[model samples]
Target: MSEARKLLVLVGSPRRDGNTAMLAEGVQRGAAASGTQATLRFADDYITDFLRDCRTCRRSDGECAISDRFRTLFLEDFLPADGVVFCTPIYWYGMSGQTKTFFDRTFCYYAGSYPQSEEVLEAMCRKRIGLVLASEETYPGAALGIIHQIQEFSRYTHSEFVGTVGGIGNRRGEVAHDPRDPMRGAERLGREMFTRHYADYRADTPRSTGVWCG
Candidate 1:
């Protein structure tokens, strides 16, 4: 028997049953149909309070210092997952502060203070595939910027950027209500993930070598 693949979906919206959640649900449906384990995690459950910019983890065990509810996510759930899906609603032309903060805190692991070899970071990246699903009712640039952020994340971490699905002109379950919109795209993305073993193709080098879109 083959091992079951695992995909982690992170919902960055504070509201439950929102557009982001709906998209994540679609992705989960696809993953399950393909025989993969799809895990959904909501940021509302992970974030307790606003992050106050404590970089202590950089100085210590390469772990975030403000350690509260999110620590387990950073240490356990995130690192071990075979793939990652970030679903965030556009806020102020970018990702929600909650999602941004979560990515920012990961700087602890990248600071290289734990004496772990670059090989370790490379392995972490190679083992993961990242997906971003964002939506906004207005300017599509916001969603584009969020995707760019994910691309940059993959580049620096040497991870795989599997692509993103953005739904424009939608708000508060608008996409969810429409059956032909995001859910269809999200499910297709999930199906694609199941067919490919992302970890095998991901490398420490960018796909275009500094030309962006890693």
Candidate 2:
């Protein structure tokens, strides 16, 4: 059997019981069923002040210049995960601002600011990534812009973009009631996290944003 891996799920929705959160919960359920250790965090739970531009702060050590909750999130929570799952609700054709804030904090991992970035960043390369997104828009491409960013980020970080589950619902907790069973798709994607490749899985199918399941 594969050894248990630590999976970190980041819920980017400020609404604790929103559609995205339900998707995240489904993923967690699947992770737990597979006997993987999983942890869930809300983006709003982290203190994300606007990244102050400065030259004299800490950078060479490969540490974030900011001394807020973001630093703790990076050094303690994010880096330690063997895999990461990003669950967000689309807003204005992009991820929620709170979630974006967490992502924007990655600049702290740059060579100048974070001297040990190479080590931590290299460690991240070994991890896998999954995405679960919800949107109010019903169009097939509603979440593509956000998905593209995530795909690029995965590549830049050297993490394998394992799979995605994009759901559509304007109301809170609609993911559970969607006809397509997006929660089921999210759970399946989570279970497949230990074993599948997104490229191979989507090889024969055309990319469609309306397609919520993997």
- Which candidate number maximizes TM-score? 2
Error of 2 at 93 (Å): 0.2
Cα lDDT tens digits for candidate 2, 72-178 = 67667788888899999988888889888888776666545566767767766767899999987778787888889988988877678888898878888776777
Name model 2 segments beyond 4 Å from true: 1-3, 54-65, 198-214
In model 1, the runs with Cα more than 4 Å from the true position are 49-64, 114-123, 127-130, 169-171, 177-180, 194-214
Each prediction's Cα lDDT score? 0.69, 0.80
Residue range 1-214, candidate 1, lDDT tens digits: 9888888888888878677778888888888888888888887687665554444423454445564677677657777778888888788778888788788666545445645535446545854554655555645565677778887877776777775776543666787555447688888777667454343234674554343345
Residue pairs with backbone atoms closer than 3 Å in model 2 (clashes) = 59-112, 59-113, 61-115, 62-114, 62-115, 63-114
Residue 145 local lDDT, model 2: 89
lDDT of 2 at 20: 93
Alpha-carbon TM-score of each model against the true structure: 0.77, 0.85
RMSD to the true structure for each prediction, in A, is: 5.7, 5.4
